[model samples]
Target: MQYHYEFILATMAVLGILFLFTFFKTVLPIRRNRMFRWLLVAESVTLIFNVLSTWYNSSFGQVPLIVINTFDVLFFIGFVSRDFLFYCYIESLVQERAPAIRLPRFLVWTVVEVSLLLILTSPWSGIVYSINDSGYHIGRFYRLVLYTNAYSYLLFSIGIVLAAISRNVLARIERFSLIGACLILVVGNIMRMLYPTYLLMDSFYMISILVMYLSFQNPDLYIERKTGLLNQSAALSILQEFGKRETFSVFALVLDDFSENRRLYGVRQMDAGLRIIADYLRTRYPDCFIAYLEEGRFMLIARQVLPVTTMCRDFDRRLQEPWHDIHVSLYLTASYVAFCGPLQVERPDIFLNYVATALRRAEEENQLVVIDEQERQRADHDAKIRAAVDWAITNNTVEVYYQPLYGTKEQRIIGAEALSRIVDPELGMISPGEFIQVAERSGSITQLGEQVFEKVCAFLAHQDAVALGIEKINVNLSPIQCRDERMPERLLAIAGNHHIDLSRFKLEITESALADRNVLQNNMKRLQEQHAVFSLDDFGTGYSNLMRVLRFPFSDVKLDMSFVQAYFSRHNRLLPAIIDGFQSFGVQVTAEGVETREMARELTRLGCSILQGYYFSKPLPEKEFLAYVARTQHDPEHTIRF
Candidate 1:
């Protein structure tokens, strides 16, 4: 019974290189990767023990009986353990993709326990192998153990194929690689049994592992090359594995206004700064899972409570100094949002969205926020609102409500302001302010605006505004809507579809819409060409610049309700002067929030041509608004008294 060692040594060399690559490249502590690494260890150990056992058996006359027994027993244990580890690796891979498909743990462990017990008792009972003074010999149950091992491989291959067929989440190449590994092991065992003198099993194992590595385990998929931190995919993989059951803390550091920074500092310099930040975090928290989420954002995850305050302080302090070698003093502001808990969402994507919302909120409020129950509720609510918005727009459930605007000179309802309203069956009347903000943030504002505009067109076409003494209907536009290059054409097409005149459409825009003056000006000019009118709404809110207002062709400027309320309640002198200046520029001043007749009289005296508030009418559905206009036209005292 002579054994060849050349093929065995060659296989060991290849496996050694493969094991090192797998060990060093696998940075994420994800369950699947960990299982695969353990499988590699088992393979390496089994190969070494097999080589030792082979050498000792060749020198059976010279080597001690105890050493031969020890090496052979260890080799068998390692051999059996390799199959189990491969099974675990496959199970973890499937679980990561489709967590529902779990194999029977009790059945697997039962088989493993029995196999290990038989191997452990083999030296005394000689059930698996025997070492007589003549030579090493296979015992009675050796063939049975080999059959069982081959059966397990066949079972694993079947399981992998079944799981792959049932779940589309597993990649095709991954499924094939896994199934191929099992089949390769089984075939290698059969071939070794046919040719007892040839050492082929270890070589086959090496080939199977190489197949897996080439298919999916490439380090570049998960590592961010520039920053040397795990990339977004790696972060997501770790989160998906532990998000539902594990309690951990996640700290997100997002660059404030990342787009602006990218534009200002250039992409290369910003990337250099990101690398510096990554290095700082990686050095400070060596044990934590650090991921560079790109766009000047990094995520730090830890299983235990972290010194968040100390870490943030040190992070900020380190960032104050200019990036080394880059030499440019890049001042990057970072928003911090931290939370420690089991993510309640069912999927990793939802959890990521919730974290992103928290980060954006932190950036907007300019504060470090620890996400608590209230913040979680807010995130959930925003998610629901986003869903509701999508459903409403998709189902055409978005309704338009009109609030009448009163003409001071005529003392009649001259126009109305179109507002969007969403009434969820469960949530019931979501606030316009809240839903609008959610829609804008979720990038659904343009679609929502289109839906509302189309509905308004339908209302204007069906209802006779001239018959009701209505001159125009004001529709509010968000900054995001105005930035769209096709918004003007979309609005005109909607109005044309309904055979409505564009002149009767006074598109109201908030001061924030002035952020991109060129886009707004271009859209405004295109709309005005078709006889549409423009009005600056929310005049006294953020970034209120009168000179910026004059950049577009604005027919009207509505004083924000805040300014109107301040003027009427606290005698805000600035409001009156601002109104006078806009009026003098030949822009009709429409005072919003004129809730009382006294306030209306004062605003009219202050030369405001149009007054809109609850004093005239709260925003009403199409039927109610039309009826109110008709009633006011017949009863002039209705406007003065009501």
Candidate 2:
């Protein structure tokens, strides 16, 4: 049979180009990329040996029997290994998306080993192929090996399809693309079995390689367009692999005033400046993995501990010099953070969070920040707390605790303040101060505040606070929530759902919330129309003034705990002066943090009509708060002594 070799040569040429590009240009040390490069190598070797076997077989007795046997055995070996390599490449893709789904290595390797054994002994046993003096002949077991390869392709397709269906991480297009690659190989296998003289399988290999390359191995997917460097996605993938298997170091570069520079230089010039920085890192540190995390953030990762002091000094000096080639000598201020560790963390997301936090600290302190073990632990704890906050808000499990307000003259509970709390199953009793800030930073405060308001209204609907001598309950509003123009409407809707009276609820606002006077005024007006009372909370701590206080229609003003403690410690005249100034405007004074009898008595004598502190009662759950209110009704002054 005369075999056509033109198509085989052409396909090999194309495969060679792809192999070179994948090896040299797109060598991202991610699992998928490495597996893809392996597939390319396997395919190229298979084609080269297939072409050699065809040539030697065509010469017949001209070539030595040893040469014929060697080329035929090598060709079969490459052929059998090609399907296993394809399976490995798909496994890499699946594992990347669903890291938990591990295909058993032993089962597949067992079949591959048996196939190789049959091929290795084929020259003597005639199990796979035989190169006699006449020509190369398919042995009795050649069909067996071909069928095994076909089944392997079928198994790979089935597994990829299942992974696509089960793992939401695998998109439909990606799953189908993987299955398509498998189907192409299967079809090529069938054609080779049917027409052995066509030499068509290599062409199919090229097509399959093209499909896999476009689907997963394309360099553009992992490169940032603006800076032409490895992107955030690539960095995360590499970091995830390294974090699992090896020790590494990460040097983070954050532009301190990226926004300011972009505004001054315009988008195009700033992007160009970023590209220049990326190029500098790439050229200066060829051994390091460079990634651009957009908005003037870049990362250089190395397998060993970087020379922190020297590298930072070099980068600092380079940054100090003005950038050339731009119309203006573009000046960029950057903050650098270096981290070296075994970093025994399982998830790369947490490590990336640590990097982000470290970058922020470096920018704030205007110095290089080398993260120590304590900082790493803190960052890990913060990530966990943030995740817990998310879980609480998402599950609507945020609890509300009430702290009772004591009227000086009445000497009983007048009202209570509702505080949000989360008791995580794993992390018990997270501090309100800690989780509240996390919620606010993560923009979950809106949902958190809404849940608290609903729970408070539910409490009012069921508990009968008025009968308990509690006139109103104070609910604090987050500044982020207050900024929303529809905050009043959302709160009212929640309250209205439970048929609670707004007049019985005093919405507390912080001094910081007053930064946006227009939004605050609008929200206050809308809520006030519903008979909601407004109070200035934590006053005399932030940027508080009588004028700012009077600007908003606050029916009550609460002195900050710090001021109360300071007055008790130093007998500060400013405390009484501020109290008198607030009282003169007919804004009722409520003193916070009256932690002792003396502080309480002095604050009461200072003409504060309302007193709230640990001395009276610490924040309590609903049942305890109601029980305390009931006790205060009888022995209002001595019910709960500090």
TM-score of 1: 0.70
Off by over 4 Å in 1: 1-21, 36-94, 106-218, 223-232, 241-247, 254-276, 292-297, 315-335, 341-354, 357-368, 409-411, 486-493, 516-531, 569-572, 580-586, 640-642
| Candidate 2, 377-477: lDDT as tens digits | 77878878899999998898899999999988776789999999999998999998889878876788889989999999999999877787899999999
State every prediction's TM-score relative to the real structure.
Answer: 0.70, 0.68
**Candidate with the greatest TM-score versus the true structure:** 1
Overall lDDT per candidate, in order of appearance: 0.82, 0.83
Prediction-by-prediction clash tally = 0, 0
How close to the true structure is residue 574 of candidate 1, measured as C-alpha lDDT? Answer: 88
* Cand. 2 Cα-lDDT: 0.83
- Pairs that collide in candidate 2 are none
On residues 1-642, what C-alpha lDDT tens digit does candidate 1 reach at each position? 788777887787778787778877555667878887888888888889898998888788898898898999888888888888777877776666666676677877776678889988998999999888888888899978856965774596568657766767666776677778778877888888898787778888888878877776777778898898988778878888767666988888888888777666777887787887788787888878998876677889888887888878877887677676545557877889898888776556667777787888888997888888888788888889899988998899999999999898887889999999999987899999989988987788988988988988888888778888888889888889999999988898899899898998899998877867688889998999899999999888766677778878998998989988987678677877887788778988999998887998888888998999988789999999887887878876564553
Clashes counted in candidate 1 amount to 0
- Residue 372 lDDT in candidate 2: 83
